[model samples]
Target: MRLYFFSGLTTSCNTLKFDSLKLHNETSNHVTSNNITDESYWYYKNSVDGLWRRWDISVNSETNVAAWKMKWLNQEPKNILGVIVYLTSVRELPQLNISLLSLRQNLFKPRPIVIFHEGDFNNVNVQLALATTLGTNIPISFEHIRFPTKISIKSKIGDLRLGYNHMCKFFAIMLPYHPLISSTFTFYLRLDYHSYLLGPPLTYDLFDHMQINQFQYAFLMVSTDELKFVRELWVLFQEFLNDSCIKPSSAVKKTQITAATGLYSQAVVFNNFEVSNGSLWRNEPRIHAWLRKVDNAQGIYMYRWGDAPIRTLAVTQFLDDNQVVKFRDIGYFHRREYTCSSRMHSCSIPSYHRLASHIVYREGCHP
Candidate 1:
C-alpha cells in the first residue's frame, strides 16, 4: 500500500508519515513555465507499456498505418519495446542475403528485438494471408546505426530515423501504425516507454520500512495529477514533515535520461516541427481526416493543438529532398540536399529547407 501525497507546502519529513511502504526515497518536483522535466519523469516512470491493447484485423491488399494511444499504467510499469521492417514488395519472397531479423542492427552493435514479414503485394484483391500471418510476431526494433536519434521501420532501403509526435510533454504507449486492409492491408503498431527500475540486475529488493510506508500512501494517490486537485494536500504533506519524528522513505524509481528535460519533449518538438512544416502526408484536410482515431484506438485522448483535429493534423510541407520516394501520389519523399553529414550536423531541419528553393528528391535518391 504505497502512498504519496503533495501540496504547495509539502516537505521531505511528513512526506514519509507513511513512508514505511515506499519502494524508493524522497522525490522532489517543481514546475517551470517551459519545464520538460516533470513530463519526462512521468514518461520514464509511467508511460512505458501503459496503454490498453486494442486488437484490429484486416484483409486484402493495401497499406495502412496507425499511431495509437499511449498513457500511464498505475499497475506494473516497464519500458517500451517495438520493431518495424519491410518484408517484401513482390508477391513472393526475394532471394535476399539475410532475413531482416538476422540483419545486424548496425555496423557495430546488435539490435535486441527483431521482426520480419514474408511475401509481397502483387495481388491487390488478394488477402495477405501468409504475409500478415508472419507479421504478428515481428517485435519492433530499430537499427542501432540510427544513433543519438532516428528509428526506421522496414529495411526497405532508406534511412528513416525520424518519428512523429504532437508533444505537450505527455506520452503514452502509442500504436502509431494500425495496418488494416479489407481489400486493404494495414500496419498495426504500439508505442510505450517505461522506467529502468524494473530492469535487469540488482534492483529494489531492500528492507526499508519507512520508505515503504510513504510509498503505500503515494500509491493510493491515483496519479501525481489527481493529488493536485485536492486543496492543501501539499500543506497536509508539510504538516507531516514538521513532526521530525517521521523518517524519509526509500523508493527506487527509474526514468530516461530525457526525464530531466521532459521525456522526448525536445525531440517531439523537433520532429513535429519538421513534419508540421514538412511534407509527410498527401493533403492537409485529407491528412486531418486520417488523423481521427477509429475503433476507440490508443492514441486519441481528446484533441489539442487547436482542438480542431483538422488543423492539428493539417499538412504543412510536401517537399522531399533526399531520394525521390512517393507514397502513392499523395506527395513525394526525398532526402534533403543539405543534411547533417557525419562530419557536420550543421544545417538544422529549417536550415535544410533553406538550401534548395524546393526539395528535389523527385530529382534523385542519392548524392
Candidate 2:
C-alpha cells in the first residue's frame, strides 16, 4: 500500500482498509485464467452480489427531458452557442443579480443564461427584473425543476428540509441531459448564485477557448470535501467499475486508488465555477450508466453528497488529464475560497483568501 503525506502529517492507505479477505472469498467461485494479469478483470470477477445492481430508474433521453418545465423569457438564441447555467431560488435573487452583473462586466461576449428553480416562477415582476439585470441582448430562460416521482419517492433519507440534496442530484446527474442544454449548447458553465467573476474583462470567449483548445473540463479551484459525506462513495465507485467492466484511465486509476487508501480527501474540482463540454456527458453511454448507478444509490439524500466530489470521480474515471484544463487568467470567488491572476488589479477578494493548500494558484502566485 502507498502512503500519502498531507500538511506535514503522514497517513497510510491501510488506515481505511477494504475487506480483502471478504472480497477474495466472494470471488473464489469464479474461474481465473492462468495468464490473465489485468487487475480490472479481477475487479470484474470479484463483483459483490447486490452492491451495484441495475435499478428501475429512467435516465434515458426522453424521460430526462420530460422531467423539467422550461420557459424562455426571450426568443431562444438563433445560433447554437455555449450557455451559462444558474440553479437558483427566490432567496438568492439578490446575489443572483450581483453574479449576473459581474458576468456582464467581465465576460468577453454575451452568452445565454438558463436559470433553474424548484417551484413555480409565475411572478412576472421578478422575471422582468432578472431579464433587465441580464440585459436585453442576452437570451434568458427559466426552467422549473420538477422532481421525478420515481426518484423522489426513493430518496429515503430524512434530511429534506432545505432541498440542498436535491440540488446535488440535479447538477450532478440531470443537468447534462436537460433538453435545452443537450440539444443546443456545445458547452455549459455552472456558476452558483454566490460565485463571482472578479477581474479585468476576459480577453476571449471562454466557450470558444474550450472548443479551440479541445478541453472537455475546466475549473478555477480545487478543494477537498468532508469525510463524512464520502465515506462509502469510493467503495461504491469501485464496485461500479468492477460490475460494469469499465477500466478507468491510467491517471485516474493511479490517483483514485491512492486516494481511496485514505478516504478520498485529495483534490476535488470546485464545481461551482466549472465549465464542461456538453457532449461528454450527453453522448457517452458509459458515463450515463455510471450516473444512473450513482443516482440509484440514494447517497445524495442519505449523506448529503455534494456534486463537486461526484463530478470529480466522474472526471478522473472517464476523462484524461489532457482533456482537463485549469484556468489562470480569470479571477474567481465563491464562499470563502478565491483565486485570481497576479495581474488582476480589480479582484475584490484579498490575496490571502487564496492561501489555502487546496486552492490551485496561477503559475507565479505564491500561497
Candidate 3:
C-alpha cells in the first residue's frame, strides 16, 4: 500500500511518497490501517512524535511559510465541476445513506462523492453497503484519514469531544490540501452526516452557479458562536490584523462590531452546508498565512475554536461582500437548525422550526 505525507513547510508542499507499507484488516473495534506496521510511518502519525511536531514547530518559525500544493495523479478527472464530500464513520453509515439518497433525488445533476473516514471502514461489508446506496452510476471514492490528535497540552474548553475538534481542523485546514480533491474538483461542498436537503429538487447546478458568478464561497445559514469557545479568538485575529496590516472590509466592519459596546460580535457563517471554491482556500497566500497563524496558536485544540468562526473571520477580513454569498431557496436541515424556502413545499420540518435567532432568512423565507 502507498502512504502519502504532506510536508509541513509551505516551500516543500510536494507529496512525500512512501510506497512499501502493507495493508492490514483489523477487528471491528480497532481502527484499520494501510501502513500501521511501518516504522517510517511515525513521521506522519498523529502524535507528538509525528506530523504534529513538525506542524507545530514549522508553523511558528518565521522562515517557514505554510501552503497547500496541488499534485495530480496519473488518472485525471474529466470535466468534473465539483464533489460532494462527507467526513463520516461506521456509526454514521445509516445517516450517510439517507444523505446520499437525498442528493440523488434532489440534485439537478449528479456530482462525484467522496467519503472520508478515520480507517474504520476497511472491510468488505461496509464498502458493499456504500456502493449499494449510491449505486453504479455516480462516482464515489473512499479515502482513509489519520485520526486527529491534541496539538497543545492546554485543557480543552467546554464539553466538546476530540472528534469535534478534529472535524473543525479537518474542514478548516486539511480538506483542501487533499491530493485527489485538489486535482479533481473546482469546488467542494461539505455536508455533515446529519445534514439533508429538504426542498424541491435543486433547479440549478450549484457549481455552475458559483463559477458563472465568480463567487468564492456560499453558505446556507449564519449563526453566532458560543462566547466561551471564542473569547480570545477575536483578540488573536486583531493581533494578526495589526501585524499583517490587512484592512477589514466594510462587510466585516459592519457585521462584527457591536453597536453599543463596539466589540466583536459572535456572528459566524454556518459551514455544515458550505460550498467553496477550491482555489480560494488552497492557493491564496494570505489565507495560508492566516491559517498557519491560527494553527500555531493551538486555538483549535485548546479552545475548541470551530472552523465556522475561523472561516467566518477569514471571509470577512479577506473577501468582499460580492465574493461571498448567502444561499437561499434551498431548504436545508442539520441538527436543530433548519431553513425552509417559502416557495418550496417539500420541507418535512414544521414551519415553527424555521424561527431561530441565529438563522438569517431572505427571499420568500421569513422569520
Highest lDDT: give the candidate number. Answer: 3
TM-score of 2: 0.73
Specify the highest-TM-score model's number: 3
1 versus 3: better TM-score goes to: 3
Using Cα atoms with residue i matched to residue i, what is each candidate's TM-score against the true structure? 0.20, 0.73, 0.75
Per-residue CA lDDT of candidate 3, range 111-224, in tens?
A: 777777766765657766776676665666666556534333464665557678778888887676554345457789999887778767888888888888888888777767
Q: What's the lDDT for residue 44 in model 2?
A: 13
Once fitted onto the true fold, the runs of candidate 1 whose alpha carbons sit more than 4 angstroms away are 1-107, 112-171, 175-268, 271-342, 345-367
lDDT (10s digit) by residue, model 2, range 1-367: 0111111111223333323211121211222332324322111111112111111124333332232233556555655658899888888887788888889888888888888775544477888888888787777776654443333433344445336776787778777756556556778999998787877678888888888877788877665677767757877787877765565555454544555464344456778988898767755555666677787787887767788878878887776556777777788777666677646643556443344443434431223
Q: Count the backbone clashes (under 3 Å) in each candidate.
A: 88, 0, 0
TM-score of predicted structure 1: 0.20
Tell me the deviation in Å of residue 256 in model 1: 19
Candidates by TM-score, descending order: 3, 2, 1
lDDT of each: 0.20, 0.63, 0.64
Error of 3 at 67 (Å): 18
